[model samples]
Target: MTTTATAGADAVVVGAGHNGLVAANLLADAGWDILVLEATQAPGGAVRSAEVTAPGYLSDLYSSFYPLGYASPVLRGLDLDRYGLTWTHAPDVLAHLLPDGRAAVVNRDVDTTAASLEAFAPGDGDRWRHAYADWREVAEPMLDTITTPFPPVRGGLTLLRRLRVSGALRLARRLVVPVRKLGDELFDGDGGPALLAGCALHTDLSPEEAGSGVYGWLLAMLGQQVGWPVPVGGSQKITDALVARLVARGGRIDYGARVDRVLTARGRAMGVRTVGGATWRARRAVLADIPAPALFLDLVGAAALPPRLVEDLAHFKWDGSTLKVDWALSAPVPWKNRAVAAAGTVHLGADLDGLTTYSAALARGEVPRDPFLLVGQMSVADPSHSPPGTESLWSYTHLPFRRHWRAEEIAGHVERMEEVLEEAAPGFRSLIVGRHVAGPADLEQGDPSLVGGAVGGGTAAAYQQLFLRPIPGLGRADTPVDRLFLASSSAHPGGGVHGAPGANAARAALARDRALTGELYAGVIGAAHRAVYR
Candidate 1:
């Protein structure tokens, strides 16, 4: 049953991305009158897919690969494959180009990856294997903890049981361990840190950052287990399928509607106001898939929010840096390191010293002399992202988002980016037919959710994670504003294309209801939040 009156709508969602769509779908299925307002003409903000350059070339607008989505039990429960979502995985998980004309490849076959590590450093194989095993033991449970709206109690206990006795004593220390130190401690040879460091750097994390080492190693294990698979038609298919299901379930999406504020009465959020002067009241709740800063500073307004919230908001650390350059190529990238060509994704940097230099420069708000680049070959992974016989390459290196681009700043950064590619893929630039560059500003234009070009919404650093995310002591999905909640990457389990934040938000809203809708949302959310938090 749908809402007989537009004014009787039970909830309003500010964005129609995967997370927003997931939240909307849950509400609609429960017989709530729901209206999802999307600022973009299209749905799926970062997950949007289109033929950006040429015909038959469907490029994912922003996010590309998603292991998080695959591992997610929340999105999986939706059975999106039936609605038009297919995944294609390469045999090799990834590869990183070393300064010394060699490459390290992480393969889905554990023995193969271990053997590769053994080739570089003999005893490292056993160590790597042990790490993978450890991850498999706690992977799903750990994911459940961060994603659920409530604190993950049982998941934490189960995970603690899996931890090595000694490992338990130093959980906090382990989280704070630098990536370099963690790699060096676990794997004794060159291949160890090189492979793990590259993985750690995947999400704008510096090797020296506390908790990054753990983040890197775990994702690498996940890759070896699942191979960072790209969807057959780009990441957008995930969103489209979810949206299609939502509409089929009697949901409605209103595009080109930009929300400017969340309306509240007596400290309880009840509706949202669009910039165009339209106010839609929510009978139950409102979900904002926007970043916390925008939600608090602009939408909610600092005056309305608590002082601690405003201060906490100011202290939020954003992993600053991203320079995306999408290229239309004549042929596939030819690599000097053969392994680089075979691997779906590549990480580029000269050495530990080189990466350290860039990290320091970035911290100081100055563009790095040499930026570490992450390159993705869209056509190689999924031809749908490019025309036939032609290729589309996605490459970007991090640089401090500061003023004073000085004449050669952008030019030098671009030169270094191309040079990094050329070093691994020797004939890369020569095959380029067209190019488009996106700095932080361009990314902001694409979606306000990607604040300051931080695609993860905010830094995925250890300090800002878990219950402390967005702010400390408020990870229950419910804001101080009562029915208002965050339903985007900015919320916990933090980042990636998975729909946990949206699911968590919807479950919280449905908790206020007790009918069939409440029962369904409760079960799905219960399977998560309770399995973890309670």
Candidate 2:
């Protein structure tokens, strides 16, 4: 590897994931010289793609859907279409299959989606429509609030103004309730509840978990507005577009430059030293797009962190691991419900009870016999992903983090997943032209940020969300270390393709550059810390 003795930049960003790229772009746009160092030869991290199964088939190795990506204020502000990024939406957004040959389909049209739920039961359509109408009123402000800095004073005030004090309190109560309980109270049929429950499965949370209702509600509402769109080519197009935009703005990225330590002086980050014996000096700030544990313990070193933070890091809980599989199919998936074929995504497993069992099994450190699968029919969503008449499809399931799966065990799990799919779509196995399976270990090997395959940065439990994310202190992007920022998904708002963490980090870094503003914001955050952690 080529190594430079020393380099200087206004800001040094560790890792070139989407978050890191966002930081680099924003800083560069501000006329600051930026340098992004990625450990891998290529950037994008988990948001990557390749022909894993067959030569002509394009498969997204990790993330595929972009409901959050589309709704993200930071991303929407960037005219990515000029940089060769286009979105493709399927005829339907998502479908959750049931054992009874019925499906709960989510469509871009609220009325149509409600109709699908109404078919399962009489009054569910009206209930869904009513809920969706309420969502529309507060959706924009809610997105702004969650995706903004901690405390969200401005966004919170806006929400309060929109809904009076009692209404705002009621909304908060609804957000904290478990999806299962909310579903039971709102809808009489299984279709609406099952659909919401399946959305909850995207996280490590079970339907019975309190904060899980928020994730389910958010994704479902975003689907109605954005339709779970994908890139026209593949997921890598997103990374490519970001890289292009960053480079155009005078940002520089060095591949295969793994940071070994964050250089500090007088309690402030100065620069970074790489494993390859090169140093990159940061004149302004250092932003880490890595996991929190790796940032504090490994790179910054435990000796540099506060004892209390070190303790918190030791006890930090991670979400469950993941098992992903991609297939190159000779024909489309033979779904029992043909309408499912028109959808971009599918959820398979048992009903709500089965989903609860799956979550319980993960918590118990045991693999579920019937794993819940999140399936992506890439070719169905974007035909350019594969050759004509063929399909490029992928699916992923959650597993217990403690389970150390061997090669044989991994194969067994893959077979079991195939069986589950076959049960839903008969003869699915016969259509497979080639296949690739990635267990939890493989996921980590591909991207260290996905520690133990915990994709959402860390467990997004009720106690670990919002103000308590990554730790129970102030949830701002600024760290205890001066001039150092945590710009990874491990920060507040956690994971997904949304660039909120990066944007928040950038704002913090920019604030620090202006001393008065930084001091004022710091005081506000300190007060919030006392209010929340006290």
Candidate 3:
């Protein structure tokens, strides 16, 4: 109800998550006045850290490792290290522990990782090395292609030049292959295959799902190249560094200012009104860094959206809900296999078939009795996470999306998860000095963007990726409403710590400011939207 006329900025970012912050910083760097509105009390949306389990123990609230963040050119180009962001890594990147004593570890050293794989099956080490080498050939251009705007202009052109005709077709075919198939085709043993499948689980995709192979291969290779680094102090260090960089560039942030509605005039976004009745106007553009459903249905309103968009939204599938447990351990986890202790991340409770069964259970809307867990050994990765000789640990598992979660179910799932961990590491429960549990509702309460505890914005399934992301429309940041952009994980290139969505939104906004070509480009984009949405 209160309009602050003087509180006008060239651009207004609707959320202070990493994507929103990244967008704001890029806009600020261009000498534009930027104002970021965050619903939470802090900037980091899910990329936050706190001592939830006990004092002197730091735990990553949502996301911990940063392979994507490190490999992202948009983030790397910012040089956040100068702003106090220090990355630390463990001896190994990740480990996949099977029910048996065997462990598949991905080490920073490719030869070491190969050797581990070779143990599972003969000549598997050489096969892994070959796959890694093939990855190296297209890694740079592929990374560029995925993180840049849709159509990938420069990155795509460069990739075509690097791998002409047959090579390009081969890579394209591999990208669409199922993770299960990729593993079977590439590795002779369960070791390398299990490692890739576990990495693929990082997304909502099952090992049997199409497009899961790309995620598995990409993440596993990134682990080899970047070692799944984490901030020295906590995940908050990354947020602090980004905030510092944005602030130094004259950008401003307003926390606890939940934007309820995006104000529009003549079909263009002009500002946003917060829940507290304060209106903040945007002189040029408004970029929404929240989830697609929330931005389209709640803030923008269904009446304002096209009927087709609304219909498509009705069919929009969220990834999956989650259940997480954090523990402040009195001592390190007593793993039966000592190799797992050297890695920052550990995947447990599933093999390839088990992973398929888990995914199937989710599709059936039933919680799997045996959930596959993605666990983080914080203290192992960074010694500063807890008191000397102690450990800070956390694990999360995906569940089927539901309207509500009962407390009893949450507790039951937590127990099941711990039992899995206990089996892998005997006496693990005895080491827990304190513990914290976050169910689907608990996670959503902390961050609204994590709707139903779906972390990756939306499902990473083949039917919902690339040009089909969010909906059947242009894969660019521009929206149906002029001057409004989707800068969230729901956009093209999908989710990760990478700042592609935000960077693409910023670039789109900047393109609209050019003198002569700007108007023409807008007309063309506007036409395209009408054709698609109609």
- What tens digits encode model 1's per-residue C-alpha lDDT throughout 1-534? 222223636889989878899898878778887889998888887887666655555666688877778877788888889899889976577887888877778888888888878878878888889888877876777777756776778767776787866656665465678888988888877786787888777766778888888777767877888888888878888888988888888788888889888888987787888866777888888998888788889999987776767877888877675677778888888887677776778888756666777787887887776678878878777877776888888887776753224535666778888887877677888988777777766677887677667788778887788777876754656676667878887788778877988998888887846556665754564444333322
Each candidate structure's TM-score, on Cα atoms with residue i matched to residue i, is 0.91, 0.97, 0.99
Question: What ranking emerges by TM-score with the best candidate at the front?
Answer: 3, 2, 1
Relative to the true structure, candidate 2 reaches a TM of 0.97
lDDT of 3 by residue, 1-534 (tens): 555544789999999999999999999999999999999899888899999999999999999999999889999988999999999998899999987778999999999999999999999999999999898988899999999888888877877898898888999999999999999999988988899999999888888888999999999999988789999999898889899999999999989999999998888998999986788899889999999999999999988888999899888889999888999999998999998998899999988899999989998999999999999999999999999999999999999987499999999999999999999999999999899999988888898899989998999998887878888889889988888999999998888888899998999998977778888878989999899999
Q: By the TM-score metric, which is better: model 1 or model 3?
A: 3
**Residue 201 accuracy (lDDT) in model 1:** 77
Clashing pairs in 2: none
Q: After superposition, how far is residue 92 of candidate 3 from its true place, in Å?
A: 0.8
User: Which 10 residues in a row give candidate 1 its minimum summed lDDT?
Assistant: 525-534
By TM-score, the best candidate is 3
Q: Please, what is the whole-model Cα lDDT of each candidate in the order they appear?
A: 0.77, 0.88, 0.91
Q: What are the runs in model 3 whose C-alpha is more than 4 Å off?
A: 1-6
